[model samples]
Target: MNDTSLKANFLSFTGRAKILHMTWFAFFVTFLVWFSHAPLLLAIQESMGLSDQQIKTLLILNVALTIPARIITGMLVDVYGPRKTYSAMLVATAGLCFFFAAATSFEALALARFLMGFVGAGFVIGIRMISEWYPAKQLGLAEGIYKGMGNVGSAVAAITLPTLAIMFGGEDGWRYATAVTGVIALLYSIVYYKSVSDTPVGSTYFKPNKSGGLEVTSKRDFFFYLIMNIPMYGALAVLTWKVSGLGLLSELSANIVYGLLVAIYLFQARQIYNVNREIFHTPVEPVLQYNFKQVAILSLAYAVTFGSELAVVSMLPLFFKDTFLIPMSLAGIFGACFAITDVLSCPSGGFISDKFGRKTSLVILLSGAAVGFFAMSQIGSDWPISLAVVVMVISSFFLGSAAGCVFAVVPLIKRRLTGQIAGMVGAYGNIGAVLFLTVFSLVSPSAFFMTIAGGIALAAITSMFLEEPKNTLAEVMPDGTIQLIEVH
Candidate 1:
């Protein structure tokens, strides 16, 4: 079938497409609950008498746990399958939503937000789900549709929560509004659990060889995997530092958290060593071997694409207001235009990657994003407002599309390892958001755009080293038979 037929199939609820719709809606609900507080932060502050520092702390804490949560969720999904994993997460986070909404103290709110970070890991779960249901020929577009549509949950939250808050009509209206999201989540958990399977009937659900960490083919790749894990821990440390800098945590507490992070990293490294220890003594069969560089390069590219997109989304309103002397409300509309492009751009990127070659599509998309960001850096007060908005939309398309292209290649790496690989790459996207947000805090907006452009350009160069995936992947099935899964 052609792209048109496939896209038409996407609109209907049947077969694998039914699974795709259900899975993406699960993701959509997760994002909805995950970002529910963003639109209501002002009301939350007013109701709880939160200081600016405390509010910022809540935001930092919100994402702090997600860096590790994605990694943990990836492992769980591979072990337990997406159906159980996602349903459990939704149920758990529903309770968190109620807890956050009911919290009377800043400490309670902070704790709730920190735990809610797990919801961000919902993205990784569906990547494995869609890959399980879709063929290599349509995987990119399927994954893209899943992401592009599901991501609108945040926008939906932004649009609807405030109205709901007003409809409730009280100082604690935000609380009521927030609790409704939990209700949605709690109800959807059951719907998702009953509606989906790990894979289609009779299709094998692949699992990693070892449970502790990603399996690698060689000792060198083993070390490389360990090194890649450091940045995730580092991102958490950075959040700790940011909170401490705001005087939300005492220096002693910050030091303790830092020490704990180090200890946890050591524990995780040991687990990774345990999982891949066999590689140290024996070489993996050539047929089972897959390069670790694909994960590394995609992680970097996602850091540039999704990471910058998040950072820019957060600050764009202020940047637009200050640069163009527009009203803050109007600027917010303009800022939102950037993210709105994700709906179309993400699927388009995946389609491009599907129709063309993965490596070539990714290189061009990243390079185009770099150029788009470079164009954004040149925007100034002297430019026409309309022209600036055009530049923002065009640039955002490249960034969003690049992110879609990164994930297009993720699942084809190794069937059993897709969850872990998606987890690491997904986590890096969060790391990028954290690191780039930090840069935004420290530098001029123009400088921030330039920095991202440079990073994306470097990632594009890195993409040249990413070997295209083989036409088929070899997975050992139950009863000791090897199954050749067509990838391309």
Candidate 2:
């Protein structure tokens, strides 16, 4: 394609483009609030006189609610629609932000942090919204843009909120600054609700036939789906165990929390079965008969990209402080490279897929990211901190781009179930974090890099199974009229 034609396809925002932009911004605010504590944790520790164990417990609490929250939110988005669901989530998140900002003790902080995890669920909503707007062929690139741009919210918090806290000054500065983020959430909820719709004009929004469950087309897929869900709930059980059962929590609290977690996971499993129960009797026909290979490959791809990032992000500050002898404050500034690269690389990754092809773009990106991680293993003991920072940024570019590569293809598979599909794909990213961070606990930095390389290589081989978008998707309405949605 010529430059003009490529520009028209990518830069077109008159219809879904505007909504894509708006939806990503809504996702951005979710992360901003979700991670608002990171930059202020030190201050919170200082002001609250918390013990090391309490601090660690708080960190565990931050992500504990998100696993099941995303599963439920994914189902809700399909039923209530992404537009309404996203709006309601924003309002709920802003309220959690207020609770967090006003917390004056360890108990309050723990409650607030757990509540904030709900914002992380917002990621699932936009998967459906973006899928509604784009066709199969261009789905990868468009979904990539929506995901990558929205992910920059983590970078934004890393870059801006701490400084905002400093500017405000005083012991309670972090609190006021956090409240400022809450204001953004409250205002944006209004903006997003008014600015976008779930479907474009003249198009009908198709709700899923089953609520609280995923509709499967085959018996094998039904079992496969259940196996996949194990990790989602298992990850939560792990977090709860770490918080209450391990040294982080007292023995008494751990036992209680563990019991609570088991109950919750069982409840969710029941819901999952409810959603997929129809497949046991008879398979449902697909709107577009694409292989699940694309979704499976993308899930593995993100495990390395976003997954490794999460593992590395939690440790980067300490890595800088130890390796380069930087102060805690400066270490944080340097560590920000891991996140800031998303603004560019994620979009660039998607754009490349649009220009070339999905499978090719992902293979290239995963290969480069493997090298980036390997290079990261070799930061010389005598190297200046700048060199290490440069290495991280380069690695982040590939990592962020690979993230773009994954989402660029997410929406193309099943437009109607994009939220559920994206939720599953997106959850693998968190799974990577749990698995990789566990490895980080056991090995040297070099081993961590090597393990990630091995994982990415596996993901690359799986990429072979993804088929490029072609022809048109056949959407059969309940009235038995079929509409052909063009992929070109």
Candidate 3:
């Protein structure tokens, strides 16, 4: 189908599409509640007499748990399905949100904030769900819309939560504002559960034949899987070390900490087997198999796109204030435009992928992103701020489109294993965030932008190997009957 032909795909009502919309909305609320403290940090710091280092720690604590959360949640999602799992997570996090809002002491808030980080894993669950709902030809756009819209939750928190706090009009205004978001989360969990089914009611939901680790068909893929898993665990370990402030292990207890790390690693490796073991012993029919390379490619693509976006948002306000010599308020306003672009551009990218070919669309977008970031890196201090803003927006569009394009094919890889695939791919996005943020910590903004450019080029090269959507494939039902499905 051409771009115009794919236009009709968006307007039609789909049970899976409705579920996609609902699932992300819940994800959106979780983010709002998750980051509510950020906008109100000043108030919180003043009220609690928090030091800069302590507040920074709290900020770090907010996302520190999400790496494990994504991996663990990926396993559970395959076993339990996104419907029950995501709703349950949102509801539980809502309770945590209440704890965060109600906490009077920094320690109490810190604990609550850290635990709530699990909710950020909501992004991984929906990836599997979207893959199930759409055919392969359109999966890119469908996944794009879901991720793009849900991702706006971060921007929403940044833009609206502070205004909400002010509207409530008191020292406790931030508290009241936060509680309201939590309440929305609690109520919406029920609505999400009611609005969506795990799959079409009559359609069989395929389950992984075994549980614990992901099985690979080839020994080579098994090694590749192990290699990919390293970053996920390493990211977690890094977060742990960061929290413990253990540069030399002088400030924290290393023995207990290393033991804790070992325990988590064993648990994660076991989970990898749960998803992969069956694929090793029982060879899938040739038609049902997907390349591990595809997963690796998308993971790297996400590392560059979503990964850089996350790191950029975290630093852009500082980038703005320092480069432009603007007030904090003005810098914040300039910084926010980067986020707003994700919402519109993400869906647009998805739509483009659905209308055009997924691989074709992705290649074009990645190429655009490479150029965009390269330009951004070259922008000197004497460059026009408005021109810089224009450059940033352009960069965001390419980045968002690339995200839409990456997910477009996620579901088409393995139908029964969609959850695990999405989980791994989604985890890579987090891994990207961890990787980029780590790079940012070590390098200058110019170097950071250049690193991202190199990543985009790598992803584009991988995109060359991807096969475009072909309509013939078989999805084996729960009953063990093969049903030929049209992917395009």
Candidate 4:
């Protein structure tokens, strides 16, 4: 594949490029709806007469269900194809958006936000869709473009929602502003359904052997997969604890919720065992096997990169306004700078991975993110606001780029399991958000930045073990013929 020629054709909306554009736009709409509340949070607080603690809980609730939603979405996309899965998700989340806009109480608002987290899973669908359309050689850039553009949804919300609210000219302006995003989502869902496909004409759309859980090639990986799943549930438990701490749940309710999480984890483990039980009796042949450690390392990498991005985007508007005494609208624009970096940084990360090596690109970006975040930890009220914004942009560049690098490799792990792998990795990113946001609720902003810096540093260290994709991957066709797909 000639990359230069392909790059020239990026603007051509035909063939695989059309799918890329359509899918990314679908993802963009989902994220726009998912985070439509962040910039207008102050208005929400005032409108609903919410407490400070409740406002923070709303941020936490915004990302909570995304953990499981991403996992479930991964399975659904793999089984039903991205076209159907993504369209249906958009339609459902559109209703959730309307419900949130109509909320008159904090409890109703929180419930609506929790359900809206499901929209976050739309990212996983495009990961699978783009991988199916693009060859491995060009996949990094393709996926980068997909994510970089799609992620602008959050930034778009930050930059526009405040103004949209102001234009409506009333206390209920925020409510109307939010409802408009739902209308866009509802309309786009139909457009997306009619305009795209599962794959290019005549291409095979691979399916996993099982649907209940990720299929592992060995017993060790089976257990390792189970271990990795714990953190996702653990993140949920942490959210429950935090909400209970805020008096949102009673002692009995919190304890019961914890018990339910444990039961759910055990049930999931049983399903995993059923899917990979054959591994105990027969080892997977080497040609068809890939390392599970790769997935683990990438998941951790995303936890810090995209995870911190989500957490920061949610809080940065407030952080800037509080620290600099700026107006809410100006603070939101500054916050937009963080995610806007994705336009260049994310695609750059993928392009770098395509040119260099995946492991090298990931390690360098992760290390840079740690340094960038450490710099952010030093920001104070005494510092110039301009300098603070500069620090944030630089840090966001590394963080967004690292996210691009993480997904650049996700599709190479196993073509058939790409959706599931993306789902698990994406879920960890939320887990990172939940934990980091919880820390933010308890500690100062400086402490929150340092905590994220430490997490990224740890992920960088673990990334040393990541194995790069081989030149080709062998898959069995439906007719029992072995097909080798070029990866490098």
Candidate 5:
């Protein structure tokens, strides 16, 4: 089908298209609930008599759980399938939202916010679902639409929740607004569970051959997997250090958490060994082998793409307010334009990948992103505000598109292992956020932008090593028959 026909068919509410829409909406609602509190932080702080330190703690707690949760959710989706996994996550996050809304104390609210981080894992579930329904030719656009639209949830929350709070009209308006998100989450959980299936009719839903950790096809890949896992734990440690530096945890508690992280890494390494131990003694069949370099490179690329996105989105409003001498509201509007572009930019990246090639699209997008950020770093008070906004919008387009391009290659890696692969890649985005945000904390905005540009330059170079997906990827069936899925 031509691209125009495929896009027109995307509007129809039947077959694979329906699944695509349903899954993306499911992801959207989860993100809406996940970020519902961000735009209402002032209201939350005023109503609760919160100090700046306490509010910062709440922000830290919000993302602390997501890194590990994505890893776990990936494993569960691979084991239980997206239908069940997505539904359960929605239901659980609804409960957490309600808990957050009803909290009467800082401790209760912090715990609820921390637990709500798991809602972010909902993105990985839909990835596997979309991969199952769409062919390789259309997979990039489909996954892009799913991710790009779903990502709008955060922007939606930013745009709508404050207004909803005002409509409720009281000191507790934020609470009521938050409760509304919870109620919607509760209703949609049921809607999603009843409406979606793990795979299309007559198609097999591939599952991982082993559980606990991702199964690598060779000893070298096994060691590479372990090395890649280090950054995730390191990111968690950074969060712990940040929190401790803020005096949220005692030094003793911080040390204990550090020890716990080390122990967890050791345990995870053992799990990886247990899952791939056979590779130490016997070589995996050539047909089943996949390069771990693909996963590593994609992870690094996403750290630059989506990771910088999260960090930038969090700081952009402040950056504009301080640099451009704008009102908070107008600065927020400018900042929001960055995320809003995801609706178009992400799908554009994916379509470009579908029409051109994955590696080519990513390199071009990342290169543009590098240039965009470098330009942004040069902005100052003397620059026209409109020009600055244009620069930011351009930077956002390349960054969001690069993110879309990264995921376009994810589902093509290994059919049965798609969830785990998406999980690791997604987690790296968080790791990138933590890394970049840390740099922002220690440097000026210009320096921060320069650092991100440098990171993108590195990612663009690393992406040069990426091998595009071929025409077919082989998977073994229950009866030992080889099934080939079209990938190119």
Candidate 6:
């Protein structure tokens, strides 16, 4: 589509543009609910008389459940549809938000925060929804706009929630501010359900033949997929260890959590086997086969890109306040600058991927992110405040663009399996956060930045293995006729 047509399409109320609007708003609300506590974290800590370690624990808890939730939400969206899955998630988010807002103790707050991580999985639903509406040629731009804009909710929370809390002007102001976000999410969930459809009229929505796990084409891929799943659980175990080390959980409780993780991993592995066992008996045709390695690499890429985004956004305000001795309000605004870059940078990455090759775009963006993080590692109190803020904004731009580039390749991999693939990749983002944030909890700010830089460098090397998408993908239609979908 030309620029004029594209602008008109975006402005129009009918067709894919409307779906894009509704779906992005759904994602926006989910993110707003998921990170609602971030800007007001200090207020919550003061209100509850929490310790520094407790604050760190809450940040970690915020992302803990998202790792597994993305995997589950992905399957649900693939089987049911984005409309149902997103609406249900929003309802859940509303409840979690209310629970968190009304929490009277740390334990209650922690549980509510953990449950709210499920809201993060809402991102996966929109990926599938957008792929259904857009063609391959225009997919990157569309998906980028959706993600970049939706991500603004986090920035919105950072910028507005603090001010809202101030406006309410009391020890309980943060509580009321947080509750308002839930009410809006609850109302919007109903509105979203009414506004969108699973697919365009006359189009058939594809479902996976099996549920509970991703279906791989080859026996080797089945094993690889299982192996890739290990890190997700391992990240959770690391979080448990970190919390236990903080004296937050008893030894017996930590051990029980560890055992529970092991059992869940085994159960998930069996589900994967059940889903893909048929592949061993009957080999999948080459025409329908895809490389599991692509998924693995993208997962790692997202772990670094979006994962770093989560870990950094969570701690940046605190980092700024502690390191620079700035007021919390100013620190929050600075923290928001990191995420606000998404508006321009994310779409830029997608546009680059669409114009340049996908693999090439990812490599370039990932490299820039590694370098940017390395630069961030060098910042200290001696640095000028303006200079420090500029570095943060620049680093954020590269990281956000890298995230856009990663998803640009996701939908092109396998159309029908987009939800599952997006889910796995998205989960890895949280896994990355858990890993990086765990490192942050243990080390100094400089060391944490360095650790992230190392991880991004490694992910950039991994991106070299990804194969670019082919021109088209073949699928069997409901009428038993072969259909070709453009991918590149």
Each prediction's RMSD over C-alphas, in Å, is 1.6, 2.9, 2.9, 2.2, 1.6, 2.3
User: What TM-scores do the predictions have?
Assistant: 0.98, 0.91, 0.91, 0.94, 0.98, 0.93
- What is the lDDT, from 0 to 100, of the residue 13 in candidate 5? 85
Q: Which stretches of candidate 3 lie above 4 Å from their native place?
A: 1-17, 246-255, 270-282
Candidate achieving the largest lDDT: 5
The order of the candidates by lDDT, greatest first, is 5, 1, 4, 6, 2, 3
Q: lDDT tens digits, residues 240-351, model 2?
A: 6667644667777867876777787677668867876766886566654555556667777887788898898888888888877879889887777787777788878887
Tens digits of per-residue lDDT, candidate 5, 283-331, equal 9889888999999999999999999999998899999999988999999
Clash list (residue pairs), candidate 5: none
The better candidate by TM-score, 1 or 2, is 1
- Number of backbone clashes in candidate 5: 0
What do the candidate models score in CA lDDT, each in turn? 0.92, 0.79, 0.79, 0.91, 0.93, 0.89
Candidate 1 residue-wise lDDT, 161-238, digit = tens: 999999998999999999999999999999999999989888999898789888889888888998999999899999
Better of 1 and 6 by TM-score: 1
Q: Model 6: per-residue lDDT, tens digit, 1-488?
A: 35553442666668899999999888998998888998798999898999999998898788888888999998999999999999999899999999999999999999999888788889999999998888766777788889999998887887789899999988999999999899989999899999999987877787787898998888899989989999998999998998898899999999999999999999999999988888989998888889999999999999998888888987899999998999998997898788789988877888888889899989989999999999999999999989999988988888988899888899888777889999999999988888887788789989999999999999999999899999887666877676677787
**Over 4 Å off in model 1, which ranges?**
1-8
Q: Is 3 or 4 the stronger prediction by TM-score?
A: 4
Residue 232 Cα positional deviation in candidate 3, in Å, after optimal superposition: 0.9
List pairs with backbone clashes in candidate 6: none
lDDT of 4 by residue, 289-360 (tens): 988999999999998898898789878999999999999889978987887899889888898898899999
- Between prediction 5 and prediction 6, which has the larger TM-score? 5
> Alpha carbon lDDT of residue 353, candidate 4?
90
Give the candidates in order of TM-score, highest first: 1, 5, 4, 6, 3, 2
